[model samples]
Target: MSAESKPLSGLRVLVPRGGTWGELVSKALREQGASTVIAPLVDFGHTSEEDKLVDALHRLEAGDFQWMTATSATVVDVLAHHQAVIPKHTEVAVVGEATLQAFEAAGYEVARTPQDGDNTTEGLLKVWPEIETDEVLKVLTLRSDVAKPVLTEGLISRGHDVTQVVAFRTVGVPASVHIREDVQSGRINALLIASPAIAREVAKQFPDIPENTIVACVGPHTHEAAIDSGVKHTAEHVESDMKHALIETVESVIDQSDMLD
Candidate 1:
């Protein structure tokens, strides 16, 4: 437990992701002595193209792919739902801390998480593993239908065999009425946006956020998404990595907000 006199003592933060993601953010906030509101604003649904996903999973289990990749935990949820199995020989690469944690929690060992610090396709491409000359790696990428094809295209450009499959659908889940009202009324001091999808939901669900509310994003891409969604959160709210980065960024935001006061 954190000391009650921590920097974030009086803050009321809104964690807009659910499942383990929400739990992680909430726990981190609590550890910083901040109160958290776990109001999930988005949820996953079956992949739009289920048949294709199943076929890809079958190929993956048959060892037809050399490397399998997961960009989000929802992909793992899809695997759990279908009881999909990966051949022991097929290496797994995951992006993002949450996805990596979820992947490990599912009892799978990860082979790579791109050496580049950024958690984007560019990062994966920049540090795409070097394989032996005799082996042409066939890669399976689990993705959301709306996610950009940067990773697939990048892998293809590098001469790797890439099969990109949509494993889940991202859709908005309405926040509880009181949660929405609190954000609108400026009662929640800070809002944490872990993904572009969550940024879109926060923008849509709370179109008129109070100026004092700090809307923070997990990284550059999510920050860009917030901007694209007309989410008016200050440009200073992007953290590039995990728990420590998030906590540091949140504390900075709080300190700056105090300076303004």
Candidate 2:
């Protein structure tokens, strides 16, 4: 394809998902002709905390919990690694389809999931009360270090004994010299913030991004973080999911730039 025909030709985008997720976003951006940079803001690794997770599994098998929630697919993987089992009687809820799929693959039935408009905590809360309250509901929440407390706090407010576990830690990856050089030289046109954690890390590493660069956040939370960090132009995905939102935001940015020409 000619350079002019390429969707993101002459644009450079940075993706900071911090692991396999970053790779997925990077690959998609590259296919669209955006020079992609992968700078993970966190790293995932197994830790001795598996014991606590194992204990949680025991609680699950004993039918001690009424509901289980997973925020990330990585949490599901960590649960599986510890051989966590979901009791047949326990209901499961997840933030995204990928997490639901992971639960299904692990032989658990998903009781609730966020639909098109309900991908946020507020969206999930609309249907949360429908769950039986008399059943001594113990909610096992699996997440990373920097997860939002909204979900767990909400569950607790509704009379659920919520056990929130940090399934993994988010550690920043040391940026390569090339990434720093490109970013400082104003070659990076836009930075895609997939999560609030990544956005915070980016703000810490590069306190002063070029004035002309655009900031596209995957969701409201990340968008807020970007704004808090003093990013001038910020956009949130109409759709809640990261992949779709990132692609749509990138396309929108490209279209708007073309219109200005």
Candidate 3:
């Protein structure tokens, strides 16, 4: 493959997740001439366990909560299902601008957001001190089942009454026949994994991708998951955002593949 020929001209890319973030990555790969296949390895849905979240909202209405944290846009979607509006008194803290936009679209305002950095638990905690905790400080965390307890533990360490509510659950989608065929036939040249859950599901479905297949991840958490799942060759941190990370990873892989050929 020459520079004129390009590295990803005939490459097939597999996107194991489906969401606004995943769509962004897919679009970028298509623009680069990669045959993008969306297998949607994970599905997110609101669970029937809303009583705890409803009770938390009641507490927020009673002015018991000081801050509410939403780690992902899916969290905002699940939260909106229970409460029509988030209490104006309770400060909203989120991880990404997309999450903040979702909150705002749902008629809530975000007080703090991690614009820079890895957008991980540690990044959110660095801005935690700015929040006042003179009162009981109810910290309601709307998250998925696969979410880590790091944020909750950090808030507790800061003397806040942290209540983590499982707003949504991540269900693994079995790999489709087409995806299986693509993998078995060695058509997929790269795998773009954005979430840890997706990485786990991919590992389960295609236990051994072709040795030439490139493994690219969005952030440190996903990278750790990929490594744990036995994905040997991984891309470095491109950006905290999923779309940019995928784009950069694809470009890098294309460059490397071109060099090798």
Summarize candidate 3's per-residue lDDT along 21-86 as a digit string, tens digits: 445556767666567887888877655567776787677667777788876767665655655456
Candidate 2 lDDT over 1-261, as tens digits, reads: 876666666667887643334444566666666777777655666544667777777888899887888766567667666776777888888765445555677677888866554565556777765544565577888776666666788888877789987677666666677777777678876777666666766787776677666666655666777678765452442432434545574432221101110
Taking the tens digit of each residue's C-alpha lDDT, what string does model 1 give over 1-261?
A: 446657567678888767656666677677777788988788788877899999999998888998988777677778888999888899887666667777888889988775534655566556654542455789998888666666677777777888888777888899988998898888897887766888888888888888766777655677688889989764433332333445564433221101110
Give me the runs in candidate 2 sitting further than 4 Å from their true place.
1-10, 18-35, 45-52, 61-63, 80-89, 101-109, 128-134, 185-187, 207-212, 217-261
Candidate 3, overall lDDT?
A: 0.66
What TM-score do all the candidates reach, one by one?
0.78, 0.66, 0.70
Error of 2 at 21 (Å): 4.2
- Full-model lDDT for every candidate: 0.72, 0.64, 0.66
Residue 14, candidate 1: C-alpha displacement in angstroms:
1.1
Q: Largest lDDT belongs to which candidate?
A: 1
Clashes of 3: 0
Candidate order by decreasing TM-score: 1, 3, 2
Best-to-worst order by lDDT is 1, 3, 2
